[model samples]
Target: MKRPLVSAAVVATMLSSAVATQTYADDALVVSSKIDTEGSVLGQMILQRLSAAGLEVEDRLQLGGTSIVREALLNGEIDIYPEYTGNGAFFHDMTDSPVWHDAQQAYDTVKAKDAELGLEWLTPASANNTYAISVRGDVARENGLETLEDMASFINDGGDYKLAASTDFVESAFALPAFEAAYGFSLDDDDLLVLSGGNTAATMRAAAQQTSGVNSAMTYGTDGGLQALDLVVMTDTKGVQPVYQPAPVIRRAALDNHPEIAAALAPVFESLSLETLQRLNGDVAVNGLDPAKVAADYLATLED
Candidate 1:
């Protein structure tokens, strides 16, 4: 026999003394996310899509960081959340494997491994959103530097060059060193303006306005500030960084009961190209718009 449908009010009443309705620690298909802007927006998008699909949901948005949310899901406190494909390497200790650098291999490895723990990895979005290097539009246009290989040639020819980058990018295996290894170009300490502890925005802004003679900045492919700052993301043709594509992950038990969840999200994620996500992120990150509003606007576009 089917258990009677539980009303939101009744569920709220039960969990009120324990936790907020959004953070209800029950088996009602609770959806959750981390405390970052990307997490909030993507989690909200998943939550709203489930609700719109007529699936009863508990909106547990911004619950915590990746570890916290992963713990909640595994402990049966939440049913589903967004996760990156590349994270599985560390989560499962597969960093030594080459799968993380390849999209399909990473997806396959993660899905297969997580299934053993009763988690279902759903379809992922197309947007990679991984690390990239951006040069000022004029700099790229003048030198035809559209990809890492182009940058290599320009640097090899001793073209004027200076890069503003985060300290991590300077030392990380998948960053500058990898670029040099793949593209056959090298930049000594003299060529880099190491921000030490700076964020992408600072580096991007420096390059955008040509402050300090910085001609390039490190960025993510989906950074909202790219087009606005007239910067072009250099293509990672050699696949240096690990692919960080987003996917909806659900508890196998929850999926068994509400399979429609996958169908509803498939279309949404499919439509979310890298360009689309950047604009949506810009609304929240750069334009100071509310995350819910940005999600609503994008959903409206889908309906139209």
Candidate 2:
């Protein structure tokens, strides 16, 4: 999800023309990004909230990856898009930096970088992108394994367990490399059951529900099944992965036109807890409900 960020030249035009039009009511700001089911639902929720606040959504372009969306932002093709904080680190080549510990640091770093490009990084939500190794609750309880460190020594001492991992896990700094370095153990090729082309949630569900060859799978900490199927996400005692708080990044000109946007959005997105996010994700990803309807219902609840 990498792309050429927007340049200052494009943002200058947007700012210069913003002050001239009283009839620009129909001149809706554009928002565009990738279309990952659960993740997209959250982004749509943000869009829905903004639209309800009388912001015209001239168009919504559900693209394939953040790469194109970022490029669009940089060239003034789009005004805003949902961005993850860790992505800022990766895109800015600060992947190994230790400054990004919380949402605040990530926001500040992205804002500083984007400022040079005439983009503004806004407040982040409570959701994160931490990785976890999930196992069925029954299997974990039976084997007395509660965390990655706990399972590591067991696997090291000749326990036969197949690990289901994404293809990216083989090389990603935040994926397999970090896990092995933190746990002091490694999985042999035979001990690994790799699933290519599918996402972590799909792998986790397959491992949890079906009789997959692998009993354990790599996943995110806030996956819906972690509770539904009574799965236990092994703890990372050694912090090896980077923080990934999801936040809205907008062009500076857009924020200037809608200064109240962040205050309105902050109250709604900031209070979202893990349980709430998982359940909301389940509504659309599992139950097949329309994301707009789900977002509408959830936003209504905030008023109560």
Candidate 3:
């Protein structure tokens, strides 16, 4: 059988395309995360899981804060990283919207919105690491407080209520003020011990020690020290705070290049419930274990 004649230019173009495709496929994916304990843990999990799937990956974990990491992803400086579904409200300037309070709705909204920017939101963990108000275990039990509403009522009835929190949490309109408005209670200057930085560890510790009469602290739902420090997280019964479920957000091009990325990570994230994430974060933040080692140990449990 005779093959049709091909011109030299056509052959050269075909060869160039093949080389480009090959080079693209051979490129190493850069995985990064925010400089936080949970970020490092999630980043390590992604790096290890992708490597196990026989894909080339670069470790850029613990890169920086949310803004820095998010910008890197947008500018193609990073290929993938862990992010919260709730932050989409801020990213898209929809903080006033109520969708962020719902897990599936927030995920869907962000996933759909980011698609236009060539980003993909993978399956999120069931954990909601949102802004939380935690009280000392003894205080919670004594006051019969289980939720923010209960705390509000307690405070309205002249209960002792001092909160240790970061300046950002204390001042942010969307944070403390939103809670106050939703739950119908306010904290005066004497009612708060505002810290300098937004480290939940410091706040939780202060509350644990009753620093400046602070029996309560601003915390995230999945804070590691909650259980270890005997702090009980007051439930946000009215869904006042946005849901911050961690999930891997990737550049669409990277996923297209490696379709297996989604399947490789789905079960891993699916296993991370609120309690599971708190325990994992505690393993590092409380137990002083290495984040990489903690990720490795957890991943090992999922093996067949």
Candidate 4:
């Protein structure tokens, strides 16, 4: 069969497209995270796992806070990062919706919504790093307080209950007020010692030391200092706050280029239960271990 002549311009255009595609495929994946102990830990895990899978990864861990890292992902400056599923409420302006309070529902909602933006939400860790009220070990043991409901009854029964927390937790309607409304208990002005910043470390310390008569303090579910400081996180049985499960969110383009990324990370995240994450975070925050070392040590255990 006789072939028709092709224009030189068309041939050149085809070659250009091929080169562009190849360049994109060759580009290093940029991983980033928020500026926090958990972020650093999660980011390091992502970096190490992807590298182990034989993919070139650029480290941008501890990039910034939620806004900064999230924006970077959206802007294509970062290929992947750890994000909280519950934050989807604010991300999509559905904070009033009740879906964020459920773990699976929250993850499903965000995964579907972000799909429109060409993002992929991978499997989330079992841990829900949401706001929690932790009490001293002695107080919890003495009063048999394991959940927020128990604390509410304790407070109503004139039990000595003083909480050390950040001003934001005190004033935010979605925090202490939400707990009060859901659990049917209230904390008086005298019952709180409002700190300046929202660092749970300080709050946990105050409760551990009984500073200013604080037997309780505001904390997160995965805070490392909880166990070491002898503080017990009160379970949110009422599910007042959104479920903030950590998950790896990646740009669809990057994921398409490296489909193995999902499988490589699934087991790691699956192993991260609430207690496991607490222990990992403690290694860094309490033990002062390097985040990379902590992540490497944890990942090594999976091989065994």
2 or 3, greater by TM-score:
3
Put down candidate 1 lDDT per residue, 183-256, tens digits, no spaces: 89988888888887647888889898887788999888778777778888888888888888888999999999
Expressed as tens digits, the lDDT of each residue in 141-176 for candidate 4 is 999999999999999999999999999999999899
Candidate 2 structure lDDT: 0.71
Runs of candidate 1 with Cα error greater than 4 angstroms are 1-27
Q: Cα lDDT for residue 143, model 2?
A: 89
When summed lDDT is taken over every stretch of 10 residues in candidate 3, the lowest stretch is 1-10
Q: What's the best-to-worst order under TM-score?
A: 1, 4, 3, 2
User: Per-residue lDDT for 21-43 in model 2, tens only?
Assistant: 31233478776555655456666
**Runs in model 2 with CA error above 4 Å?**
1-26, 100-104, 140-147, 153-161, 171-174, 210-213, 222-230
- Alpha-carbon RMSD of each model: 7.5, 5.5, 11.1, 11.0
**Each prediction's TM-score versus the true structure:** 0.89, 0.79, 0.84, 0.88
State which candidate, 3 or 4, has the greater TM-score. 4
lDDT per residue for candidate 3 within 1-304, as digits (tens), equals 0011245466455445533453223489999898888999999999999999999998888876676677668867689999999888878878789999988999999999999999999989988899999989998999899999899999999999899999999898878999999999989999999999888889999999999999999999998888888888888988888888999999999999999999999999999987788888999989999999999999999995
lDDT leader: 4
Candidate 1 versus the native: TM-score?
Answer: 0.89
